[model samples]
Target: MPQFVRKNGFWGVRVNWVEHLNKKTVYRRKYKQGFKTKREASMWANKFLAKANSGELVEQKIPTFPDYFMQWARIYRFTHITEVTKNRYIVTASHLESYFGSKPLNKITRSNYQEFLNEYSKDHAPSSVNKTKGLIKSCLDSAVADGLIRVNFSLGSQATGNKKKKLVVIYPNVEQIENILNLALERRKPYYPSFYIIITAILTGMRLAEICGLTWDRIDVENRTFKIDRAYNHLATDKEHIFKTLKNESSYRTIRVSHNLISVLSELKVNGSNLVFAEKNNPYKVPYSNGVKHPLKKIIKDLDYNLGDFHFHSLRHCHVALLHHDGIDWYSISKRLGHENLTTTLKTYAYLVEEDKIKSDDLIETQLDNFLTIGEKIGETSKKHKIK
Candidate 1:
């Protein structure tokens, strides 16, 4: 190693070469900013020289993102799991796979990833898009960890109801919910399964898939409870949905059946059909021959209702809000909804609550005033007794 003196009187390891275009005297600056020793500076300079001479020659071969994803999924045990996760990931990878599957891992850009999210969220709910983005981001991050990509480009955060543009928050008042139900029943529509589905969800606060896969065997009529064990889902590559286990460990818990839901189930014909909702012989995910989409749409149209387009999930929101309004603790609600923790239940349903925030605030303010009055009385009594 040797030191070269520059025109500015700085000493460092340097490389001199002819300018490729002008054939002028040229110099290359190495890590002269930090390296105090010529030997230390020369080491990095030598590596840079090696990279320049042989790095391109050796070829910086790396697997494509899709290729890496396939490899990662291969090792991952996707089998023998809940169909809910399968379908969710399938939907998630669908957006990512179509976009970056062929591109080299290093070529994926943050802007390109953001575009996928922006476009998807335009039609679907922000929560749905964010869910898909989270899975994609996790996969791409794994690619970076595996050294298949230079950096993790995808950025994901949880879905906030206020932030999602495509989300349709059509919260009907209590009167409206009852009116929708009453109207659907009055229409005498035989094709609509969502009528019962919505009723049950509003009563129980179960997730959509849980309501769809409601089984007779899981129902304990004597115990007045029901267990959630399975769910329906589709993978990204899957053309059709399939039956799978419960969505998660939390989803496997049992719920105490409400009087309305229990009464609804008790009247239904429970035959060879293991499902409480679906009929026997031609059993389905959700009960009814007409399915939820068109049949439910017809029912809503007949009633001249667009706010009721939320389908079964809205009923879940209704259940949570109903409970929240009734002074139910979040822990109980979380358990009832099969959430892993209270926080998940809180974050997911915070937006679903009505803006009738006056009740909670007014109650707290009244309690605080009472507490202060009591404290003053106790202070006065203590002074009178000369015990303070």
Candidate 2:
């Protein structure tokens, strides 16, 4: 029998073992200490009994880090996470394997993990390092739960690198956006697919993959709305292109397009691949991101917007900013953007709200100044009429 005990602020277990050869002749008492909690001690005692009953209570051969993680990916990951997310996890794990894959799981102490992160941060950006650290921590957490390790060594490890100060969101103003679209339309004539893509991004605030995923069948000409059930997954290797899921559950939505925008799309509809922005040669396959970016980069450089750091996703930000500037509420904007929640919408677009507040303050000041001037004029009139 085993039971939990606490002594000197430490939790432990005391167990009584009967003699194997002569149970009635002798009994032995044993105690184990230094468990973090009573529940941990109980779990340890339970595992001891279970393993003993199975006739294998001694130390077993432990797998190396890479082997264990790959085992987890093959056995567990597919049943839980999305296929896209599982691929990302496997990719991140592969990067980790390049470093500590040869070491046994028990040998990977907290200090060793931290050292690995430090080495990784030298070449990678802080965000990449952080994402890698997060995935490592998640994998180690599963290891802990499986009783393969006593603790998750990768927990609470921060990426060490020269992190850049967060940049202010860069988005084109209304005039600049229009000019960029016109450039796309003017250059790529005949079908004008790029022009349609740009207009769709501006009006819908969709990600590049989502824009490329759009098809003529999803559009409702009479209702003037379209469904966003899935997105183009260009980066996947093991899976087919065009995953039947978007970035998240909230990303599945229906968005209304303006009548003019709908008319433009309808005019461009032709007997080709069902995808609205499919490649010219392979209509079934969406155009590569670089194909979209090359022409857009040229347009931005021609306009001299000094937004070399910006990418196609900047169009989504510009859409949010335009809505914020137009005095749209945060909730509606979140719904329109298909954000998971209002917090995400606010966090990403807080700068736009701040700019709006500044403009509001200026307008309020001007109104107060006019009121004071009117009050002064009324006072002067009263004085002249002796009606003080």
lDDT of each: 0.63, 0.75
Return model 1's CA RMSD, one decimal. 10.7
User: Which residues of candidate 1, in runs, are more than 4 Å off?
Assistant: 1-61, 70-74, 77-101, 107-133, 153-165, 184-194, 232-243, 270-272, 288-290, 298-309, 352-357, 367-388
Q: Candidate 1 — which pairs collide?
A: 87-234, 90-236
Query: Which candidate has the highest TM-score of all?
Result: 2
Q: Write the per-residue lDDT of candidate 2 for residues 36-71, one digit (tens) a residue.
A: 899899888888777655546444567788788867
Tens digits of per-residue lDDT, candidate 1, 1-388, equal 3345443444456653222324444444343435555566677667766754543323346776656665665456366545445667656556667766677778767777666566666667656666666666777778878766777787543333324455465766666666666654554322334566656766788876677677678888788887888664423133144455676788888888766557755555543455555544445545532354454556556666667346556667777777776788788999999888888987887664334356668888999999999999999988899943
Clashing pairs for predicted structure model 2, backbone only = none
Q: Write down the TM-score for model 2.
A: 0.74
State the weakest 10-residue window (summed lDDT) of model 2: 17-26
